[model samples]
Target: MDIEDLHSWPDSVEEAEALQERLRDRVREEPGPAVVRTVAGLDVAYGSHSDEAVAAAVVVLDAATLRVVESAVAVERPSFPYVPGLFAFRELPALLSALRKLRATPDLLVCDGHGRAHFRRFGLACHLGLLTGLPAVGVGKTFLVGEHVEPGRERGSFTDLVHEGEVVGRTLRTQTGVKPVYVSVGHRVDLDTATRHVLALSPSYRLPETTRQSDRLSRAALRERESDPASAPPPAAAPRGR
Candidate 1:
């Protein structure tokens, strides 16, 4: 897979906000791959310390079989503040590195974050899709900046996630008697298609396999890094801030 670099990585909130405004237009509200063969899940696990570091994991799976086709992990230090909406700057660098290592190009990227359902309308999924030029969608466990009535306790039930008079996403019930997950379009994908793919990927669980597997892989990667003699610090070590 080819990785397109971010135009700029701004560490400050002001600059990052400016960058989001400049790049938000790049997101296309269209359908993704017609014949979905592969999908990749992305997640970043942070260290215990504020400025310690992070490990990004990309796990690609066969859309039909839901089996992993490829997996990669990258570790790197933070580059931006741990702001609510700007964590992308800290994670994107390492996530892109892992994506570049993949032998198979993914048809879609499923992010464990928000997309258009953000205050700036450009969350991690939106930012990642802009940088990689890939079809992406965000499936979040909690509401970011949206309000909606509770969906029915049945699989496939959904309601509009409206924010500031715009339906930015959907609250989808992937499993019966379980909490709903938020779905939003990232890039090169429409809200309907994004919801469909997320449901297809999550046949039995509240969260899709993509997110679950990526979560496990990323956490494992971070733990492995923490145990390495070269990476670990003394017990009396203090947290590092940005």
Candidate 2:
């Protein structure tokens, strides 16, 4: 894997924050197209060695016939460590590469992570959306950043996720009697729109079908690498500002 030389990385937390601001932007809502054609999901996981990570992108049919269409995977060394609010720096390099390899561009991206529910309101999903200039949503299994009252144990129930007294995202009950997933705007999409998309994409599960497929695909790719190290794709060129 070819990772950018970040040995001389940001000297302090303030510097990292400044750099984040320079590369980031606030999330916005988008009026998605009525006719949905394609939807993509992104998920990442560590390799068997735990030294490398495999990021996968999967596009699926969005109409009544939901089926897997295209998929891609990339491997890269983790960057920026595993800090709470800095996962993008560790994962996006590989994730971006996997996304670029996709043959189809979906109307929406369901990211397996957080978005506005972050410190700078630019979580992994938001960062990826801004970096790729695509419409994306953050669907996190765990709350990374945000506060919210629990939604009722019923499908479609929701409550606002607040941070510092400002609305940032939502806790959505995708499935009745199951824990809800956190929904947030990644980029070019509003929280309401994001929630709606998540609901539409979810046919019969707690998480959207696209994201669940991506999560499975990503982990499978990592398993493949474990079974055969020779098949792993090289990481992209060192990203700028690394």
Please report the candidate that would top TM-score against the real structure.
1
* Stretches of candidate 2 exceeding 4 Å from the true structure: 1-15, 229-237, 240-242
Determine which window of 10 residues in candidate 1 has minimal summed lDDT.
233-242
Note the clash tally of each candidate: 0, 3
Per-residue alpha-carbon lDDT of candidate 2 for residues 1-242, written as tens digits (9 for 90 to 100)? 12233323454556666756765544556765445677788888876655555555555556455687777877666655567787776677677677767766777778889988888877888777766667888999888766789999989999999999989899999989888999998888877788888887776999888788888888877777778867765653445544
lDDT of each: 0.86, 0.74
Error of 1 at 143 (Å): 1.2
| Candidate 1 lDDT by residue in tens digits, 1-242 | 76565564564689889989888888899865667899999998988885777888999999999999899998777767788878677777778878888987888999999899988999989988877788999999998897999999999999999999999999999999999999999999999999999999999899999999999999998889888859752232111211
- Measured with C-alpha atoms, the lDDT of residue 80 in candidate 2 is 51
Minimal lDDT window, size 10, model 2: 1-10
User: Model 1: residues >4 Å from true position, as ranges?
Assistant: 232-242
Indicate the residue-level lDDT of 203 in model 1. 95
Local lDDT at 204 for model 2: 90
In lDDT terms, which candidate is top? Answer: 1
